[model samples]
Target: MSLKSSITGNTKVLCVIGHPIAHSMSPIMHNAVIQDLKLDFVYVAFDILPEHLEKAVEGFKALGIKGINVTIPHKIAIMKLLDEIDPLAEKIGAINTIKNENNHLIGKNTDALGAKVALLNAGFDIMEKNVLIIGAGGAARAIAFSLSKECKKIVILNRTEQKAFSLARDLKKIATIPIEGKKLNEQHLKQYLFHSDLLINTTSVGMAPNTNTILIPKEWLSSHLFVFDVIYNPLETKLIKDAKEIGCKTLGGLDMLVNQGALAFEWWTGEKPNKILMKNKIIEFLNLKQC
Candidate 1:
């Protein structure tokens, strides 16, 4: 809590709020942008449990907190607590970005936008690509809605058939793409992999201490396809490594984290974040920090 001056107090606050937030890299990512841009703002993390969300959001306004990013257990739950929900956030039924303006809490979904930017930043055009998103949780739903605009077709693959169908029903009204959801089984995955131009893993596979794990088999991947894993701990996921061995382009989750943080930084302060500096600092920080 470093407040420079009374005049700057209201403009200098931002944070990420969620329970078990020690796993978050938001501080390192956003702090780099804050310091590099020479802003009066600082981004911190608040470990707020589900029971405290309403109070926490109210505290944001009472204390004049500028904005925050919602993660994991709170993404969907925070929707009802907001004054207004952006169309993307409403359609996805989740919010990862929020702003406090005129004492009103406005929610937005930046994860999907971040994913879209990550795909294009890696040089794969999602516009006509057949996309397969693994995991039907909030992350899956957010990406499913955002990429729906760019992808020719989008499929949700979760372990449960019912959850998959539920997720599909929610997306039917938002995207023009042929959207569907199915239980991820051997047969289901085979058919899904065969037709997919892009395979995205939104689950916690290939993450820290689980670097050896992958959601899909290497042999099933296409040689000319794009394989993306939203896991950054191991830096190169098994899917990414295997895809690279087969000459398929790959993307890790770091870019999405940085891009989304950059956008959030811009939203909080009317300044462009130094992406290269932020990316390098994130990589450097994560590489050296203990898990």
Candidate 2:
């Protein structure tokens, strides 16, 4: 173990496991909270592939590790490897947080609850609203599960209609809200965007450096709409900026990242991680590394 490791501390261990984890901000955001609160914890990233997930969890238990926050391709795969799944995680068919209680590996989905917190913090009241979600990736699935309880209707639009339909079908088994999946072609998207109370872009279309591509045309967007995009590298996506131009309330992925990490920290350590510290630390740490 590294000298800086808190493995010997009273608090348990925590890690994030994924492939291509070099770009992950989990350590920066989560470790800041650990330092700020003077908690005995260290959060690291394990760049393991899907095939290695079961071995990773087994090793955690063998090594007296406390818990982990999973991401990407491993989220769904880790579900079956865990001893228990939270209701929302079970409903969403995904896992982002895993807690190791001695030999038991428990699973939970913080992304769903995190998205709900992100939406409310963005001044959105999703209750009884018509919401349109873009992308059919893991993030999109989490957000859809989160909004299902509040939205009057949930419409998923994606380049791959089949994936969107798959997501809707999976979520319907858990959520009472009506869910619709459709292709995001010009005509179909325009119809949904204009009528949607909220437009959420979960795709990575407007990430860092590629900030010019708004998911939908700004002309079709209304000032009454609320927009959220899960891209934080540039901090603001083109969609968020266009939404701002049209006077639509908006949010970015940073809040979701922090909230979900916080929830995972709480789940493992039985303590709440500081949100502002987590957010600011991620920004500062990211900036410093770029320098």
Candidate 3:
């Protein structure tokens, strides 16, 4: 697909906002899809400070921005600023995509659905499986809540026991399956790793700048477990590497990232963008950066 040489005043704007937005691949992937579809839209990234979020959102409304993807610290904070939120997002307590419908911002969470899709596409069955999630943040909450419907049980493990318990308690209200929260320790690892069919790391422990660190001991990982780490910067985190070495199936966050962004793109443009094109663009960009 040919790139749109320039943006005109008529070019509708779509953007992603975060406190530290420099690392985002959203603009690269999204713009590729927009150009491929020949849409009159330009996507950009903005590093909006936490204090300036309200003003930034107001500016978006005033400027008639078509859509925006919220990342990082903004995901939860932006929820209160939006006019309305999707029921699932409200339940998950985070919103990643926002569509400005006639200046009334509508927030939705594509992360959960995106992860679910990615797992299914990878040939992993969530139904009747015991899932061990290694985080208590927004991503963990979203995945747990989304998988609650299909999985036999969910165990949330975090360094902070209370945070894990809080998330588990909140999710238990709507979850039909058994949910437990415990401190991420050797005992918990020994107890869950063998029985868990799936293990998802929503934490940033093995991301860039901390590339060598892995949350779980290599010996604890079983060949039967499916490992998923939501860290795409390194493409393969230490956890993913260790899991693969042990013969456990593994997946990185890039699939979820592209899938969620694709969902948001379709919702805003009412067209399904070429997802392969989007994924390739990110891979190419990351490769070039490495070189």
Candidate 4:
């Protein structure tokens, strides 16, 4: 049966909320799985302004929305608004998923789990590896917190140097790994990449409409590096293209996105959706080659 035809008064609601949410492929992958599994749930997206977040939560509670996937600006802000937070998400200071049970909201961060799974699935080992991360936003925080557990060293570079330093300091409190934050520049990019085994871009630098932009110079990349950019829109960012051209192993954000969404899916419905179906639905919708 079609998704619309399958929906009944009892069908549960699942959705993702964020500002500028039009770019999200969450609904595509999620709904595809919902339909594929014949589950009594419908997935959707909401373009929620930050100012209306509280009201949005109230509405979700009133309407008994079963699950919510938080994104972008809402990830950090929605924490205090929730009734309870998972411990790891609290440590990361961000949440990308929320479950509502009997009017109480519980928040969780699956981004870190998503990234770690994505890397390991791609055969990139993080054990004792030197890692270079770009950006100091929520995504950066989640990825850094996860990588800190196993990686030997981490250097975070952000356009605003203070944010990078602040993230580094925050991470140091919970992790024993050598973590450094510095201003993002060609000099530092070159210096860090020299010894780095993994390079992850947590920023939206090469997202759609600005696909040509690249932070690190092509010359800075080496064959020994494994580049992972968390932007999956274009499927391949300029940074990924450059790294690939230079003979470096690379992984795009599609897998990370799917893995995280899958984690949220299972947490919400107690059903493990076919991750391959979720991923391929997105790849087909984006009309792009598989990354």
User: Pick by lDDT: which candidate is best?
Assistant: 4
Q: What is candidate 1's CA lDDT for residue 231?
A: 82
Model 1 TM-score, all chains together: 0.93
Taking the tens digit of each residue's C-alpha lDDT, what string does model 4 give over 161-271?
999999999999999989999999989998899989999999999998899998888988989999999999898899999999999999999999999999999999999
List the candidate numbers ranked by lDDT, top first: 4, 3, 2, 1
For all candidates in order, the CA lDDT equals 0.83, 0.84, 0.93, 0.93
Q: What's the TM for model 3?
A: 0.98
Residue 42's lDDT within candidate 2 is 77
lDDT by residue (tens digit), candidate 2, 70-181:
8877988888888899887887888888888877888888888888998898788888999999999888998898888768999999999899999989988878988899
Backbone clash pairs for candidate 3 read none
So what's the TM-score on candidate 2?
A: 0.93
Show model 4 residue runs off by greater than 4 Å.
288-291
Most accurate candidate by TM-score: 3
Name model 1 segments beyond 4 Å from true.
1-11
Clashing pairs in 1: none
Residue 279 lDDT in model 2? Answer: 92
In model 1, what lDDT does residue 222 have? 77
Worst 10 residues of 3 by lDDT: 1-10
Report the C-alpha displacement of residue 105, candidate 2, in angstroms.
0.3
